[model samples]
Target: MKHLFLFLLTLVAFPFSYAQQAPFQDEINQFKQQDEQHFPPKNAILFVGSSSFRMWNDVQSYFPGYTIINRGFGGSTLPDVIRYAPDIIFPYHPKQIVIYCGDNDLASSDTVTAKTVFERFKTLFTMIRQKQPNVSVVFVAIKPSPSREQLMPKMKQANILIQQFLKTKPHTAFADVFTPMLNDAGKPRKELFREDMLHMKPAGYAIWQKALQPYLLK
Candidate 1:
């Protein structure tokens, strides 16, 4: 009877602890393993985020002269990015960082509110600035995927905060991909999305490449 009671107690406690700590531990472990190979203290442009970073098939080919490192993992969010920043981005000692995240968090319903997403972003930026004082941080506004189109108003709110925040700093730049990618109706251009309409097609990536080039070149 005593053993059964203890086991039941553990079961009740486990859920709360796992909810708080396990995901963070898993992200940290993933960061330690992945960053060593991709970053390695090289003079490179670090593309850090979730799937969008991972899906860039030919970043180097797009920008030939610079060393481009893709540090994107699928299904990650701002908290994961903060946990992995030292591994993936700072180790590379990047000249600039191109970041795209929060989309997955919104799409997965992992976050509670737009303000929660913005708070996470603010935390991420603060952490990066403190650790990498000289490196340029270029934030990519969350894209409008068909699956996540209903959430654009929230995204726009987040972007507005980003725009205002960047105005006060010189090293921080905001890459405004949202405006160009939108059609006259304020919807994402159909040509820019893949068949599922969640991910970007090559045509969409080309748009990013073009916008990113001038910022990096400078």
Candidate 2:
């Protein structure tokens, strides 16, 4: 009877322990592996965020002169970025950081509001500032996506909050990729997105490249 009770307790704890594993651990590990093989140069401009930055695999080509280190992982939210900042942000010792996130935070749950995302981003910004006080930070606004149109109002609010916050900080800029991605009719440009309507096609990225160019640190 004692042995059976111990076995049952172990079974109950196993799933809970497994579920507690950090999200995106595999992706973060993969980045570590890549760094070991051929580490990126320090003081380069670092692009860190969600799928948008991750999917921009050839981002270096878009900006001819700048050396960019992209550390965007797919399906990531603000908290996830914060959780892995030691691995992704600080290690690179980037002179500048370009962030494109918060969209997934709003989409992740119905209970997650615009204010929630804004607060979360502020926390991330504060973390970066504390670690690298003078690094130039450019925030690429949460974009308008056709598939997630329902969350546009929240996205817009969060972008405004983050932009306002950055305005008060030195060496910070807000790139308004959100506005240019919209059509004259105030709708997302479907042509800019891939078939899934979440990720961008090259056309969409072209818009980003143009918006972000002026903000990049030489």
Candidate 3:
């Protein structure tokens, strides 16, 4: 009885402990409440990752006839997504999962290498497969941005690794948003971004929409 009681106590405390360490507790809580009121339908597309997806408030409009659920939170890294996977990812029975995360992982001030980012992605990918064995996963290539120009080399390396990994997996697609976002000079185009030069403007998102449109399943 004591061991069973201890196990139940751990279960109760685990969520609170994770919440304290998780970057965006309030955002996760709000998502939970909103979902309870109006639950997202099963077999819809789930877009998750960093601020980029969160900032895409008009994502559904871009897809036109798709059921896209955006669970993106700002400043999220690969590990952060892994930590919050249960809340944002595992609950929904999404037909396809479109991810856009490695950008912030490489762009952040922390010291993580391209290989580290790739492995983190592999972990997340494996977890998703374990939970939803047959779900399609579309990994949006770690984009190139003018603001983080210096980190482009590492970002490209990570994108390459992920793209290759996805090619080896079934029902997976790597949306190469990075290549088209570049200019003739092989650099991020200022025209594709806002004044901040970090986030996408309409031009960049247009490219993303085109690249991802084919893989989307409504």
Candidate 4:
């Protein structure tokens, strides 16, 4: 009877402990380790979101004259970013924040609508404003990926919603990387992407660089 009771107690507590563990915790810890070694410059432009920014290993080269701290991790959804904001966002005290998220939120589940993405983005924006009221923010519009072609409508709608929301706030801008990535036939430009047809090649990043340049702070 004692053994059975102990086993039942373990079963009851196991799932709860597992559920509380955060996603991408290892990545966040790595960032913390790097920071401990040598902290990043304050007031640099911070790019935080999903794999799009994470995979941009040479983002600094494209910008030429600005300091950039790229904290994008995993195939992160907006909620993941919000969960890790204290670790990734607030510490840097960035002069500007360039976000490339939301499409992943839509792709994560069919139930996630454009409005859901919009609201998530608003929550992220509000959190940032509450912590650092004067920091500039630039949201990179979700690009049309050939692999996720079906989700484009949701992406576009989320883009429109976020763009409209940003207009109402000060020190904010929307970087339109979406329109340029689409071909003349209004489809995703396949050439811009890698063989995966999802993540971009250099060509895609080139378009993003051009779209985002005007918005980056000095």
lDDT values for all models: 0.79, 0.94, 0.90, 0.95
Positional deviation of 122 in candidate 3, in angstroms?
0.5
Off by over 4 Å in 1: 1-41
Worst lDDT 10-window in candidate 1: 22-31
lDDT per residue, candidate 1, 49-68, as tens digits?
98887788787898988877
lDDT of 3 by residue, 1-218 (tens): 99999999998878567656657878988999989999999899999999888888899999888899999997889998999899989899899999999888876765888998999999999999999999999999988889999999999899999999999999999998999999999999999898999888877888999999998875
User: What's the CA error at residue 119 for candidate 2, in Å?
Assistant: 0.6
lDDT, model 3, position 138: 98
Tens-place lDDT per residue, model 2, 1-218, is 99999999998878677678799988999999999999999899999999999999999999999999999997999999999999999999999999988989999999999899999998999999999999999999999999999999999998898999988999999999999999999899999999999999999999999999999988
| TM-score: the better of candidates 3 and 4 | 4
Candidate 4's TM-score reads 0.92
lDDT leaderboard ranking: 4, 2, 3, 1
TM-score of each: 0.81, 0.93, 0.89, 0.92
Per-residue CA lDDT of candidate 4, range 1-218, in tens? 99999989998878577667799998999999999999999999999999999999999999989999999999999999999999999999999999999878998898999999999999999999999999999999998999999999899999999999999999999999999998899999999999999999999999999999999999
Q: Could you tell me the C-alpha RMSD of candidate 1 in Å?
A: 3.9
Q: lDDT of candidate 2 vs native? A: 0.94
* Candidate 2 ranges with C-alpha deviation above 4 Å: 1-17
